[model samples]
Target chain A: MEQARPQVDLEAALAASERRFRLLADQAPVIIWRAGPDKQCDWFNKPWLDFTGRTLEQELGYGWAEGIHPDDHARCLEIYTTAFAARERFTMDYRLRRHDGVYRWIRDNGAPYYDDDGSFLGYFGSGIDVTDHVETELSLRRALSQADQYDQQQKQAQWRQEMLIHELNHRVKNTLATIQSIAMQSFRAGVDVRSGLAKFEGRLVTLSRAHDVLTQSNWLAAPLDEIVQSGIEPFRTPEDDAFTIEGPPVCLPPKMALSLAMGIHELCTNALRFGALSARGGTVRIDWQVTGDGEGEQLELTWREAGGPPVHSPGQRGFGTRLIESGLAREFGGKVTLDFAPGGLVCRVHAPLPAEEPPLVGGLVVPHH
Target chain B: MGRRVLVVEDESLVALLLEDMLLELGFTVVDVASRLETGMSAAEQAAFDVAVLDVNLGGETRSFPIADLLRRRGIPFVFATGHDPSSLERTYPDAPVVRKPFLRGDLRNALARALAG
Candidate 1:
């Protein structure tokens, strides 16, 4: 009878302990759930019911799966079932609908439940809303990718700038070499030193003027008219019409323009000393035109003088003549003829015109001056 | 006669300067070609003991092709360039280089080094 009394008290105590546990779980902040050994949900805490806004009858069995986001349904079930079969603890994240019809990210921690006798009961789990945490992680990933893209762009720009500087350095060195060559020619042996110095200064000015035209166009291409005007600008006298220039709008590449300017300067200097420009009534006519098209394009320029002293071929080819012959020919990649007719000197130039602008190599961009 | 040499330069004034330098150094100028096409033919047909090549021609053209031709014929050559000297080392590692605006002695030394190697 004493043992029977203790057993009855024990049963009552066990029932009370279970009631306390259910009360605590219902009042807890987190959503708690329990499933039966048959893999069907049997009970949900008050918080869980409130979160889903569903009655216990509607939420029995697999009804809870209806609240899971469609995208996460398969994955969530796979994880849950896999852990259930193994009777092991598991953690997972999935989006679950709230009472307000908003999907909230939930981090659920689940563990297999066991009775004191080592008999398997089912599974119990708790979930917390972690939508803010998930969103912050996603935004952080996007920001990191954007920063990577900006870093790549900055690197490319820096590389381009370095290439431009390298190209600029190369060009400056070449210009220096050109100047050195001019100096050598101006001060060569067997020439009058004083006159040579004067010629050097004149040629320097001529080179500078050509550079001025090129600078305006960023050393890309220059107009034929601009080059001619720049060449003849220094030699213009009170007689503005002493030189009659006529030419169409012809654009020449940097190398061609430079050579043409130098050639024109040489012809003008000769005319100023011995050609038509030497006399009051003398007049020099400069005419140029583009002929043909495409691959056969050519630049035909003629320099003719009238009303000058009777022309005569020089006994020896001077520096000016040699430069006009060899330099112009090479630069033009065509013929340059000086005809010392009885009337005046006629310089004729024929050269092929490139079809398009040559592509700049290495650093293609020209840095602003 | 001094060592016969060919000059492949695009710029006329620069060509003249090179010719003058070769003459002053007591080398006979075999021929001078101002364009890459003419340069190619000269490299193939011209009879010369050595050659001086300008690295960059008029536009995008480079003298590397001519350099290769000279190499095949076992002819020694020197490269003159306005570009950084190290730039040429990548393509022609063993070739001698003379920077632009160079002294007469620089040309002579480069030529000597090319011929010796």
Candidate 2:
């Protein structure tokens, strides 16, 4: 009768221990599960059932596999099975689908469990939601890659700017040499030193004006009318009819624009000094037209002066005359004619125009009247 | 009669200025070429004691090809440029270089040294 009493006490003790385990498992924050020796889940804690929004019946005995993402199911099962057979501890990360249709990343750790007698008692595992950590890591990687691309782009921009500065230095030196040459030539001609200085300054200003126009156009090309207007602006009088310029919309390349500006400036300076512009009623008419087709196309420009005193060719050719005639002609790869008529002076230039580039949106085109 | 010289400068005003300087120095300019191609042809056809080549023509073409041609013909030449002399010397170590906007004396000395060498 006493042995029977001890047996009942022992049974009661076992039931109490079981209840304690259940209570602890339910209160734990982690999701816990147990799989049988056959490697099929047989039990899950209250947290696991609540996390999956599944009833205990739906979660027990491999039923939980239904909540695993399809892409991760095969791999997860393989790892679990391999670890189970070896009775070894294992860790894995996989996506688990919740009842709300949202997939969350889960880090699962599993280890073999054994009884006091050293007999295997299936596997005990714990899982924690690691979705936030994984997502943060991925976003960090993306941000790092974007930063690397921006760094590369900045390096390239710096290299390009350095090259541009080098080229600009070279051009500046060359321009200084050109100015020196002009001064030297003017002085060597034995002309009035003061007059020569004035001429030099005038030419320099003309070059600067051309540079401004080219800079505004990104150094590619400049409009013909703009070049003429800038060159003749200083010479324009309030009378408004003393000078007339007519031309089709023409884009001159940088070199052509600069040379043409200098040439026009020389002509204007001459007119203001001794030619048509020197007199009150004199008029200067500048016109140009594009002729021919295909390879034979040419720009024909004429500078005509009238209503001034009788014109006569100078006995001695000055820098201005040479620039307007030979210098401009050579630059354009064309011919220039300068005629001193009894009524006025006439200058004509014929040259090939560069092939037109496709016009961009809001391109620089002066509308013809 | 002075020794004939060829001037290869792309800038017209600079070329004219150089021509005047050469004439004042008792050297006759045989021809002035403002481009590499023309300079090359002139170097081949013209008869001159020496040549003055601009190191760079219009920031695109170099006068090295003309210099090479002049070298082949056993003609002495000097580089006239706005670039640093050391840079030119690195390329043409044996040739003389005269910087732009040089004084008449400097040019005369350079030409003399080129002729003597």
Candidate 3:
């Protein structure tokens, strides 16, 4: 009877201790689990059950592994089994399904449990949701990559801007050289100084007008009609209908347009001095057409004068003649002819057109009646 | 009566100015070329003591080919350009550069230095 009483008391003490452990585990904020020496989970705290929305029966003996993410399944099993076999501590993070059916990251910590006699029992582990931390880290990485791309784009833009500035410097220097050359031409020996300065001033105005047209197009290409009109604008008077310009829509590159503008200026100077524009009841007809196709395309432009006093060729070639004939021919791979017929003077330009560029829209033809 | 020099410039006015400068410096102008092909031919065939090479001959064209031809002929030349001179140092380290819009003195000095050695 004494043995039976002590046995019952011991049984009661063990039951009470088990009841206290359950109560403490259920109320703790963390999810707690217990596994046996056989590596099969035996118990889960209330929090663990609530997190998985599964009963303790379903979670026993590896049933809890069903809630683990498929991607993390093998790794989690390996870590847990290795730690359990070695009777060592382990820390791991893995995705687990919650009661709401959302997968969340969980950080789990486990250590081998021991009895008072220093014998290994099983394992006691705790876990908490770490989804927020993982999401923050992932988003930070994405933002860093985007910032790197933006930095690279900014560097490319800066490099392009530097190239443009260098081009601008080269162009400006070339313009200054042109002005210097014009000055030397105007003030050369045997020329009257005042008339030379006047001519220089006139040339400056013509160059400035060309620059204005070029600036409007961002220095890319200019309409041929616009260049001609701007070139002849200074020579126009309210009284006389002495000019006719007719041409199809054509777009000239910057270099061609500048040279053409200067050429028109020179031609106008000659016409005002001795050609059609020099006499009343006289007219100058400027016409052009695109001929041929593909690579063989040519632009044939002509200037014909009519009803002027009988004309004769000049005794010696001047700067204008040299520029129009030799300069244009060499620079643009073209031919220019100046014929002084007794009726009037005629100038013809035959040049190959550049390939694969669309003509300008909205022709600006000025027809004189 | 003086050093015969060839001038290679695309712009006619600029070429004229160079000719005048060469004349003032007592250099006889043998030939003036205004395009890459012409400049190359001049560099190859023209009989001259030295050459004045415009670095850019308009558009994507450059006078490097003419410079190479002159180099192969054992002819000394000076570069005239509006670009940064240091950019040319990689290819033509010893050749002197005379900047555009230069006065008679600048061209004279560059020509002198180029022909000295």
Per-prediction DockQ comes to 0.58, 0.31, 0.46
Tell me the fnat of candidate 2.
0.32
Report how far off residue B110 is in candidate 2 (Å).
Answer: 4.1
Can you give the lDDT of residue A318 in candidate 1?
61
Q: What is the lDDT of residue A195 in candidate 3?
A: 85
Better of 1 and 2 by DockQ: 1
User: Which one wins on lDDT?
Assistant: 1
Please report, as a residue range, the 10-residue window in candidate 3 chain A with the lowest summed lDDT.
A360-369
True-vs-predicted CA distance for residue B109, candidate 3, Å? 2.8
The superposed Cα distance between candidate 1 and the true structure at residue A149, in angstroms, equals: 3.5
Give lDDT tens digits, candidate 3, residues A94-182: 99999999999999999999899989889999999889998998899999999999999999668656656666677778889988877
Better of 1 and 3 by DockQ: 1
Instruction: Indicate the DockQ of the complex predicted as candidate 2.
Output: 0.31
Off by over 4 Å in 1: A1-28, A31-104, A108-126, A316-328, A361-369, B34-38, B58-62, B83-94
**iRMSD of prediction 3:** 5.1
Rank list by DockQ: 1, 3, 2
Off by over 4 Å in 2: A1-50, A54-94, A99-102, A107-128, A272-274, A278-280, A294-297, A325-327, A356-369, B1-6, B35-51, B55-77, B83-87, B110-117
Residue-level lDDT of model 2, residues A231-297, one tens digit each, is: 8877887756688999899888766677778788888888888899989899999999999887667
Instruction: For model 3, state the Cα shift of residue B101 in Å.
Output: 0.7
The alpha-carbon lDDT assigned to residue A89 of candidate 1 equals 91
DockQ of 1: 0.58
Residue B83, candidate 1: how far off, in angstroms?
Answer: 4.6
Ranking by TM-score: 1, 3, 2
Q: Which residue runs does candidate 3 get wrong by more than 4 Å? A: A1-45, A55-97, A101-103, A107-126, A356-369, B1-4, B10-12, B23-47, B57-62, B87-91
